[model samples]
Target: MKLRTCPRLQPLKESIRFLTRKPAQFSDGSRICKRTFAGHTTAQQACDALVYNRHGHYDDVLQLEKVLLPPVGDEDLRIKMLAAPVNPADINMLQGTYAILPPFPAVGGNEGLGEVLEVGSKVCDAKPGDWVIPVDAGFGTWRMEVVCKATDVIPVAKDIPLLSAATLGVNPCTAYRMLKDFGNLKPGDTVIQNGANSAVGQAVIQIAAGMGLSTINIIRDRPNLKELKDKLKSLGASLVITEEALQKPEVTNLFKDIRRPKLALNCVGGHSAGNLLAHMEYGSTMVTYGGMAKKPVPVPAKALIFKDINVCGFWMTQWKRNNMHDLSEIKAMVAELAEMVRRGQLSVPTCTQVPFPDYKVALDATTRAYSSKHVLMME
Candidate 1:
């Protein structure tokens, strides 16, 4: 891969190894003292971030580099990051496969939890003690601190677990929106999803439970299926079945009373999705968010032509942009979801936190089909 120079990152001859003791200057021509650049200081100081000067392999390009903290603007807030999850989307972005590419010399995380360290003099939306998540996507949350507009951060309750708070901004938000936006699902209606054990799927299970909806969860066959099924059921899943079992009459009989699922949340496409469409109720909708199977949604023409089934797509990034001008709705949604978390109605996705120095472990975990979410945590 060709290494590209960052116009903004001049003066530093070496791209990856940053956060040095020398009095290096920033893109804005402001000097960052080494003491502050060391980052373990108070939130008012500079910090190090997982950055890539040019997009390529994450292990090759991503490095912890010192960054001058953006000055708190009139309506800005300074956030000290607590945790950030290493998601498939984060991997995709690192590999330059995501739809929205960050400009050169970009940071890596999208969703994470941060404590409000300091707010600009003119800010009022958030205070110093508040816990917040990104108001939109692409906040580069895998860092020590971030300073953004006050409105760019949505305050969440600090009482919840750090892992859950760290993840609330992405998978959970995606599940919540797909469950709401694509279909007019009512209480007791069944919503089937393939990646039922995934972070987003877990969020869908709990959120659906809170809304009085039933979730027909589908996961790939594994030796510990019962344990996984019990775990999802404890979170209020009405039914959890492996993709192979989906073809059996016994599974269909279980859903007889509930009727066929009216909504399908597809993350793993290909045949995993085909099974969902085959069992969908007439006039229902299937919203595809992820393609874990890395295959197309092979929907039968019969389903579309006769069953009147509707297929749609949901991306949290696009939704954020569409509602950027008006985020009151999402802010309220986030608050409600956080309450579910605080009350124990929602269980945070199983997670393993890796320290910033050991980020190679976290980055490697993303490419594998691990059951747990890998999070990057900074002390």
Candidate 2:
């Protein structure tokens, strides 16, 4: 038998030849650095990051420092960060209050979006100009740039708003997984959640609505309670009630047109978490992902034994670690959410941009009662 050459394979061969060659200059005749990527790849000479050597409050622990970029190798990609969110988890980790702690003298951010500046030999999955997110936590995303294995970053759509892409990896992914892995939720099915105004909660409201599910949002009663309810309701909530209202006899009447919730999402543990478990349907599960109240979950064992009400906890960091090798599921979920964002059906949390030089202001904001989501943008 004679081997035959295929005509259609020529373009791929040519493209590979082009990418592998070392280009010294562009059409404009500008010299390229020997260390820089030979083609579309580019990068800065140095990087800056927020890191802490001691475990303490953000006010005392975090410090900004400039550092040299690590050398890139055959399996690495250079990433230039665009924006990263300062989440409750990041703050908890900073204070040593979180379940997973990084080694001492670690960087401060867990999630963000970045631009691929360059890829080393043997790297084909990601390339220059592609927008990507970190695949694991403790990536030290608070840094201005990174040089890591190509698999360390996952590509996302560059067209989505920067804020959406920057904040997508943690909150939205957590909401998607919890809403999916816990129960067999269906259209018009009721779902109750406390901390409904939280980033994940807001995500649940929109994603659930997109799936035809109804939500009863529980928020702390504030002076501007009605306004907050209106805002959340506009985001696809079926009903919004204050924490005080959760215990009211009339609250049940709101479910007249809907069935009692089979699932409850909890982020505010303590009395708030107990209220969620108390009001959910028998045999339902309450998933707790956060404890903003800084108190223990008050679960009544009587209900657990008789009503069969179960309580559980979730940490996006742990979930990522457990499923790090197989991220195809997360990629699919992200694409789905991206479509919602593209269609304007999903909205990012209200972010207050804090430039890198004003880091102190942003760090302090994380400890306050402010409603804005603090975002650190590279200078």
Candidate 3:
């Protein structure tokens, strides 16, 4: 495997050894930090990690290094990463454009699935062989293995598809919350969303369908539009129309048969957002979660004066951060979503699985428009 040079990391020509450090005590009176490699030297325990010392162009700053993980603490679990996806948010974080940025010399990924390899004596919440995922973003999941606080990760069922498990924490969670939090939606209620082909959008379609709600999904006009529409429809979207179709007179007729959408999910801003606003029911709520168009959402004066549309935004990261201390809500949501996965209501998106050693390929594919989601498989 090719390794990138990082000034902070020295080349390892042979196996290296180190002495165990003094144990540190925590609130539970558990002392940790003392560990033995079981005859394995420090170099033997070191694993590959994609790290960036400074934020900038990913290609310029990201490096693959042999990193020795810290010993599992009294309240920690050692995990072996199974799979992770290269997401737009990961790219944005690398560019220092995301809402949350890690410190310099940070690891590069935020979402992935891992298997518990070892658990601290005090970690009764998890055990070896349990599947787990990070409870929040910025856990640096791009490495082969990690030792993290037990409370920082949540256990998930292992029966779901690898792709679904790897992606469960972010997009699916975001979709689940938005549907439940806004519009006070009930079964048979209608919802509309732009960027209907995004990972989160697809999750919205499935989760909404499972909850007996209908979705009017809108995407940009593109080649192979029929194929894309057919795919989303198969995932339980009530209607799949292009952004242009949303503005046509036929759109008015289309809504006549179905209730006007009370909740509009806007991931694409600019005029695409205006079209959503144009169709929303009076006193409806429009939740903006992304700005793929990189343009501000345009709200018409008439819509405000006549329709009284309520506008708001949601960032899943912020929501997770706010509720990290009390995970009851998050745990319940994950359980519901997991049940949906077991029932096949939620399935993996169309994606290509690239081996961990070929992460560069996955990274490149993620930047291309209309490409399948690229996942990095640790196997």
Best candidate (score: lDDT): 3
Error of 3 at 226 (Å): 1.3
Q: Would you list the C-alpha lDDT of every candidate in the order shown? A: 0.79, 0.76, 0.80
User: lDDT tens digits, residues 1-379, model 3?
Assistant: 1221222221111111131222232111111122233334364255677876667777898877656666667777888999988998899888877766655456778899999998998988888999998877777888887777788788888888878888888899999999999999999899999988999999999999988998999998998999999999999999999998888887799877788999999998999999999999999999999998899998988888889999999988778767766788888888788889999899877779999888888888887887778888887
TM-score of each: 0.88, 0.86, 0.88
lDDT of 2 by residue, 201-315 (tens): 8999998898898999998878888888889988999989888988988877876778888899988888988888777888888888888898989889887999898788877
Quote the positional error of residue 333 for candidate 2 in Å. 1.8
lDDT of 2 at 229: 85
Q: What is candidate 1's lDDT per residue for 1-379, written digit by digit as tens?
A: 1222323222222232333433344332223334354534444556778876556798788878767775666777777888888888888888777776655456778888899988788876778879998865566788887767677667788888888888888888898998887779888788999999998999999999998998899998888888989999999998888999997877768766776889999999999999899899999999999999899999899999999999989888777766767778878988888898889888877988899778889988888874478998887
Root-mean-square deviation of candidate 3: 8.4
Give candidate 1 regions above 4 Å deviation. Answer: 1-44
Model 2, runs deviating above 4 Å: 1-43
Ordered from best to worst TM-score, the candidate numbers read 3, 1, 2
Ranked candidates (lDDT, high to low): 3, 1, 2
Judged by lDDT relative to the true structure, which candidate is superior, 1 or 3?
3
Once fitted onto the true fold, the runs of candidate 3 whose alpha carbons sit more than 4 angstroms away are 1-44
Worst 10 residues of 3 by lDDT: 8-17
> Candidate 1, clashing residue pairs?
none
